[model samples]
Target: MKKKIVALTAIAVLSVGTAAQAAASSVHTVQSGDTLWSISKDNNVSVEELQAWNELDSTLIYPSQDLKVEDKVETYVVVKGDSLYKIATKHNISVDDLMNWNNISSDLIFPGEEFVLQGTKASTTNKTAQKATAPVSAPASAPVQKAPSAPVAVKAPASSTAGKEMTVTATAYTAYCAGCSGTTATGIDLRANPNQKVIAVDPSVIPLGSRVWVEGYGEAIAGDTGGAIKGNIIDLFMENKQDALNWGRQTVTIKILD
Candidate 1:
């Protein structure tokens, strides 16, 4: 009778221990001293459950072997006013770097769109890239502030009217010319606003006061016109003569905004 009583107590204890192990069982890497049973007990999982998750025929495991932990994923939903600049600013990263990170083509983004803030399962499947590091624009405590003296990022509110969309041969030019008034058609002082993005387009092709997106270049103000700029030809104003020469000529997509 005493033996039977002890047997019942042992069964109850074993049942409780199994439940505890099952509760904590998810996925864990086999550390140096880790065995299949120890891993299952620590994570509150069964050895068979771990085997099933890892598709292992036996309990044999090795260090650094990745096992399924959780199916949870991380993502971000785009809000109404979320621009690349704003989102990147929030994440403390650069606009160009963000574009590269997400493989984003243009600044255009819609609400409710999802982006992977963290890595996916495939990225973690390999032991090499255990965690993906998001680029840090700066330290977390300090807010990212642009220098007032530096040129703007060129992402301005575009005009309402998208008058035309075309492929044009764009050539760069400097403010200093042989016999030129160092001023734009719209009277923007380039000598003063040297870094300000300004482009020269034929008034007939793209009217003055128009905003445009030039491929390979950011947005620019169509505040200038050039004698040579006519029809499909556009003159992109560079800050210096060297810049003009560097961007000799290229066929670029132009989005003509109001």
Candidate 2:
């Protein structure tokens, strides 16, 4: 009877070990300032798996957080002033999914939390991109000279190849508030609000934080605008006060820098 009991205990231990190995294809040791998003990106696992395995609540995962690597894992330590968003971007995982996995109740997180890695899948869009069409403008009060044809020799960034070019396009729009940004080439002065942060932009072609030069408007950063600006265009913030007023109707070519 004694021998039989010992044998049963050994079998139970082995079963548990096998189960653990099956559930986690890889294991990651948390370093200082590790977040779930970072771990997921580093490894090829989804954020949901990270949460389900680690049982996290709140989007916050701290340094020294031990995480299961779904596949190949290279351990990384978290740095200071790291936020979940930055980490998610670094790892390429959705912040929402990261939060859900960790059972994170609040955004609150401190340094030194430990966790596992999750990964993101590539995005595939089903809808075809619509080509931009020229909109009819109100009759000008004064006669205006026709601008020269767009230059054929002008080189464009490789990113813009994703969409067809519009003869005329809406570069930016006014956002009265979140979900309230007005559209159209209404001739709002762009220089009125100077030094504003970028609200939105086309991530594929015109990356955020890129400085651009406009033919008519001088130098400006690709900053602030509506959801419609996504894809191949950019939005520039005007200086405050009369800046928006000074922006009159004009056509210009935009050049992006390296």
Candidate 3:
């Protein structure tokens, strides 16, 4: 009887230990080139859940970092052009209610930040997934023909990056042009650095804020957009008209960096 009791106790302890080990295995190690969306998909978890568990401020992650893949919680992603008031209004809740729920002391919120939204988590998950897998837009056409001194911009050549790229013509524009506002589609103010290496790309072709290398243009950000800069077309920002003219119309390779 004594031997049997000891054996049973040992079995109970072993089972509990195994359960704990199984729980710990829920963690996932981050790998190179892993985006939050990709990580969530692989783990069968949602991006909001990952953000909540890890308290992540942005979607950015580094290799060797560990992330929680289980224990999901309800959450919402704040997209671009969102304000507390705007979000509250869209959710049919009051701004004060939002602040209370999020434990936020101010009205400030940023893109990629997750919040615990009340009600209908399923809807939130679907919406988040849609955004994560949204297709890249086709490259824009050549920038509008401006003065002779303006740089001719063209679309960068295609590469094997996740986001597709296409060769298109390009034109150069100055942020300080007459009656022009220097704001980018991604909210970068070109007036702050007129000489900054930035390109106005259609948000669908190249995501805003993506770091890209323009052939002969060095490294530049796909930050701004132009009315004529649709479908494989891009407008490179130049410091002056003379520099723009010097760069008029050239085929170049665009490589999206990881």
RMSD of candidates 1 onward, in order? 29.0, 24.5, 24.0
The lDDT for every candidate, in the order shown, is: 0.53, 0.37, 0.52
Model 3: worst 10 consecutive residues (lDDT sum): 1-10
* Superior candidate under lDDT, 1 versus 2: 1
What is the Cα-based lDDT of residue 121 in candidate 3?
Answer: 22
Candidate 1 per-residue lDDT, tens place, 62-129, comes to 76676654232233334334566777666665765545434455555554343433322112111111
Candidate order, TM-score descending: 1, 3, 2
- On lDDT, the leading prediction is 1
lDDT of 1: 0.53
Regions of model 2 farther than 4 Å from truth: 1-193, 196-200, 245-249
Q: lDDT score, residue 216, model 2?
A: 48
List, residue by residue over 210-257, the lDDT tens digit for candidate 3: 556666676576667666777777788888888888888776666553
Candidate that would win on TM-score = 1
lDDT of 2: 0.37
Clashing pairs in 1: 21-44, 21-45, 22-44, 24-43, 24-44, 25-43, 25-44, 25-45
State every prediction's TM-score relative to the real structure.
0.41, 0.27, 0.38
TM-score, model 1 to reference: 0.41
